[model samples]
Target: MPELPEAETMARDLNQRVAGFTISQVLLAFEKIVASDLKNFEKTLVGHQITKVARLGKWIKFELDSGGALLAHLKMTGQFIMGDWPGHLSGQWPAHTRAAFLLTDGNSQQTLFYRDIRKFGRLRAFPQDELLSFLSQLGLGPDPLELKPEEFHQLVSIKKARLKQVLLDQSLVAGLGNIYVDESLFAAGLSPYRLATTLTADEASLLLSHIKRVLNESIAHRGSTVENYRGLEGPGSFQDQHLVYGKHGQNCPKCGQALAKARVGGRGTTYCPICQK
Candidate 1:
């Protein structure tokens, strides 16, 4: 899964390649992948110039010069590729391509393809006023990197669930998934099963600090590529630097104790019991 870091990297890559280009045409190879009405979707995007690209939590946002926006959520296996649109009916297009945007920059043309092997991603278009309402409906929480320690602690402490479950709640703190949650807990020496309300203020501060550090480090490495999480550029190297995630039976890097694995919040979780407790 491509989390915050992966989405951020994709946004940056897209900004560099297509930000100033105008959309010459829209292709919906898999119309169902679009969340908006097909007629409005294509019509709104056809002649708009992309002014900027940004990431909100784990979603990619394309800011248009026409005072509108295009948003995409790559739920599990979605990705974007840049190249020519394959010849019509030539079967040169890669499998699972859901949509394509043919772009122009006065002197050159390029096609941006949205591919999702599992077909779980969705795209939507919104005018400026409606875009604000759309984002409000999503109710995504503040980005973890920008949250103050006191605010983060209050958010988590208000939840009665286990630490891992609270961390995975996007409404409480956005952009954390299985891998980073486990890794952050390990870094902060906290148990995944620990009750959120039981953490001391100092512990909360430590956890927040570790979360920010881990996210920054992962972003530097281009995010973890444990599954279908390759950015527009390529797979990330952060998977190689993981501490407890996906290392269930391996010796704990810090404690040399056997790492333990269990199901928490219906997701596989790995942690070093000796080191984290």
Candidate 2:
């Protein structure tokens, strides 16, 4: 699944490329991908102009001039590609393309394709009032980058689950998934199995700092591309900088001991046992 950095990269890239463009038409290859009412989805977006693009946790928000919003969640293998329209009658859609938005900027036209191999991703177009209500109902926690050290400490300390499980919970700290949680824990020299309430003030502070640093660095590198994650331009290069996410049985970069893997909260977790005490 695309985490914070990956989703952030997509939002930033999309904002840069398609913010002011108008949606000339919308074609849904797979109607099931639409989370909103099928009839209202196409009616709300066909003539609207995109005003801004933003990311809320793992969801991308497209603010429209019509006062509504088109929101998307790239669940696992979803990606957006900007390219020439292959013509509706050509039947030349790219592999796994679930939706396409034909965009125009007065002179030229481009199609923004949403591809999802697993079909778990979803898109929704909501009215202004309903959009606000729907977003509020998600109950996502604060973004780690925006949280103060003291605030982070309090949030983590209140959770009774294991540290790794707490970190993975979107309601506790938004935008962290399995990949970044493992990397953040490894970077902070903390064990995944440690209880969340057992974290000292110092450990919590260090963990919060590392989480922000790691996420910013990953965004700078365009996010880790372990599987089918790609920005509007291309795949990210951060996988080369991974410290311990998928390096099970590999020697730790800090210590020479082999990295170990275990199931923490039913998620595969990798850490250096010698270094991450």
Candidate 3:
């Protein structure tokens, strides 16, 4: 899954390239990818100008001048790319193009394609009221980048679960996934297997600092392209900067001890067995 950085990169890139364009039409190759009602989805987007694009957790939010929003979650293999308007025929769409937004700015037109090879991503168009209601019902946590150090420490202190589980829980702190959690924990010299309540206030603050640093750095690099993740610009190079997220049994970069791998809440986790304590 593309985490905070990937989503942020997509938002920034799209905002620069596609903001102010009106949705003249919409095309869907895989109708199941629409999370909202089909008729309403097209009705809400067409003719509305996109004012901005932003990241809401692991999802992308495209704000409309008319107060509606087009939201998308790039689940496993989903990504957005630029393309030309195609015929209504599905055969005319690019490979893996699940959805396309036909955008116009009076003078010219463009197409923003949502391609998902795994067909696991989702796209939704919502009126202002519906968007608020859906987000509240979805129960997304506070943005990780916006939280103060004390706020983050207090939030984690009450989890009482494994550090890995606490960090990965979207309802507690949004925008964190397996890759960044492992990397942040390794940077903080903390073990994922440790209980969340075991950390001191200072330790928790340190963890948050590292988490913010890693996420910002990853965004600067456009996010890790370990799988099918890319921005309108291109694939990210942060994967090359990874310390231990995918190293598994490889030797730890810090202490030369083999990195340990295990499952936490059913997600694969890796850490330095000796350095992280």
What does candidate 1's lDDT look like per residue over 117-138, in tens digits? 9999999998788788989999
Tell me each candidate's RMSD, in Å, in order. Answer: 1.4, 1.3, 1.2
Model 1 misplaced regions, further than 4 Å: 86-92
lDDT of 3 by residue, 19-74 (tens): 98999988788999999989898999999999999999998999999888999998
Candidate 2 per-residue C-alpha lDDT over 1-277 given as tens digits, one digit per residue, 9 for 90 to 100: 9999999999999999899999998998899999888889988898889999998888898999989999999998988998887666576778899999999989878888999999999999998988888878888899998999999999999999899999998888899998899999999999999999999999999999999999999999999999779899899888898889999999998988999999999999999888886
How many backbone clashes are present in model 3? 0
Model 3 TM: 0.97
Task: Look at candidate 2 and tell me the lDDT of residue 217.
Answer: 95
lDDT of 2: 0.91
TM-score of 1: 0.96
Name the weakest run of 10 consecutive residues (lDDT summed) in model 1. Answer: 85-94
